[model samples]
Target: MKLPIYLDYNATTPVDKQVLDCLLPFFSENFGNAASRSHLYGWTAQEAVETARQQVADLIGAETKEIVFTSGATESNNLIIKGLFESSFPLKRHIITAETEHKAVLDVCKHLEKLGAEVSYLKPDNVGNITLEQVQKATREDTFLITVMFANNEIGTIQPIQAIGAWAKEKNICFHTDATQALGKISVNVNEMNIDALSLSGHKLYAPKGVGALYLKKKSPATHLMAQMDGGKHERGFRSGTLNVAGIVGLGKACELARNSLLFENQKLSVLRDKLEQGILQNVSNTQVNGNPTNRLPNLTNISFGGVDGENLLMSFRDIAVSSGSACTSASVEPSYVLKSIGLSDELAYASIRFSLGKYTTEAEIDFTIKYVREVVEALR
Candidate 1:
């Protein structure tokens, strides 16, 4: 049997070989507790960690001291939302975020709402893109923070972060964007955009998992956030516990490579994405694309095929690495919230599949998948 094709980049990504090379020394030869100050090994590890911090900062246009290493985007999101609220900053207690954010943000907001803090969830228009006007209307004089994701993982819709950030800046509200899906695939200049805080994951950008960075805008008054954990004084006491030296270094290298190669990679993936979308739509009947066409990430396509069950269609393409909303969330047996938000019915939402491309996706693979999908979709009908 041929090797299975992988297109579910939105879920996760494999580590790059270059990043792996940079991480190896930390696991064996140079292994030391970064927090231990008494020994040469410890100091060496600390230096390595700091150098990695610089690389991460360079990738996202932030200060070396502003990058806080954490477990992943989920942890970073928690730290940002909870820590900001808990900080001594003289701002309002209200938080504004979109309804389509990952469970990480949604759950945290729900938890905060339980604690008496008012939270406003702004739902985007049919294409899953939020408007600056909607944000302006939802925000209050007491609104302290506005957190929006740079891109949607399921539909690959890129948000108007710059406009939102500008509006938030004018209102003196702290703006945070979760760029986990956007960081590796797109260019994110936090300074030019006036983003107050941002989160990025390593694995999503071809580095190993277990490490991510939270970008804190320097001198933003929101820079000093409350630490979620308590232990050794690491990450300026904003995040406690000994640093993951190997993972951090890998993440830094990955960020550097991603920033350097973003444009070329996006251009390559755009062709494949177009082929996948156009082929499926032309070959199969009763299909529709989701999200803003030209304003989306270069490597993702979410298509809803009517009449056939998404799960059954997924089963037919057993060898391909595509995903159905039904398959990814099969444990729930419910329609996709993302699709429903964009005006798809329960059946259409259930029939949606997200095919996300990546750095290694090839023309032959796309051609084969398109052909296979056409055959399988027709057979299922």
Candidate 2:
């Protein structure tokens, strides 16, 4: 095992070697503008892009035509929220989301709120899971979109996305989920979940950064999203930009690998996560795991240690890379709102750390983290 262990897979994952190998040729020899249709290079590039699109689509049980590539999940979230809002502005002006959503979705919701859109942010239950009852009660005649995340990045809590999607379907409302954290960790089928649009990030699933996909159901009521960018009408005119061929290839290969290995990988991760969590809780006094004990991503655990500042705890473990909360909000001195939303006290929130395991995380690393974290907490307390 490496000295500086990485337990922050929810933030980003290192590109898989196979994915990297698939990406290298696209950067030089096979490089061509995907949009250019007048030459052989362009044809090859476009063909590669389409093939990658199919790979991404297949991972989520979406049709190839439904996949719209973007720079990353953040862009996908923006395109879904803003594009949907812009398409039906002044009419379907209400949106519903959960408070535990990543900042990408929350920030976009905030921006839309400033534009005369009514937004409802549902607070999670004590276990970091939102009740469907809350969403149903929050819905109104003007509510056209319900956006939520499939999993909580900080807590590893899985939401009932399929139930929410069913409700949305019955009400004729579009449902969008930020599946960035859930995609590779869980089995995500857009059709099974009844999701109208879904966002996934490449970096979250062992793919290269700066690549992601938005699954926009073709024959759904949610297909009327307005174009967020205007260039050469790329990505079926929904998002307009040159395709990142290398990055797309990497993303595709990663998704294929994930689809093939998810079962065994998640089972292994579950054991490691449990071992780490149990060891910490047993040896470290005043420590508690956050979020629902079950119904969460298999590869991660979030824990709050009493009387120790999270930043200080993190600093003490320089060899163990973890996080207090979402990478997007790590700079803030404030405690994690996600933890607070789940009824954690302010001090506990500040004392919390998210340790997200991954496909490559080893049993030896987990044992080391358990021993080291317990030691640090004992000294700090």
In model 2, the clashing pairs are none
lDDT of 2 by residue, 214-311 (tens): 99998886789988899989988998988999999899889999999889888888999999999999988888899899899999899988888766
Model 1 over residues 2-90: C-alpha lDDT tens digits? Answer: 55899989888988989899989999989998988999889988988988898899888888988999999999999999888877334
Off by over 4 Å in 1: 88-91, 327-331
Model 2: residues with Cα > 4 Å off, grouped in runs = 325-332
Top-scoring candidate (TM-score): 2
Cα-based lDDT for every prediction:
0.87, 0.90
TM-score versus the correct structure, for each prediction: 0.96, 0.98
Worst 10 residues of 1 by lDDT: 323-332
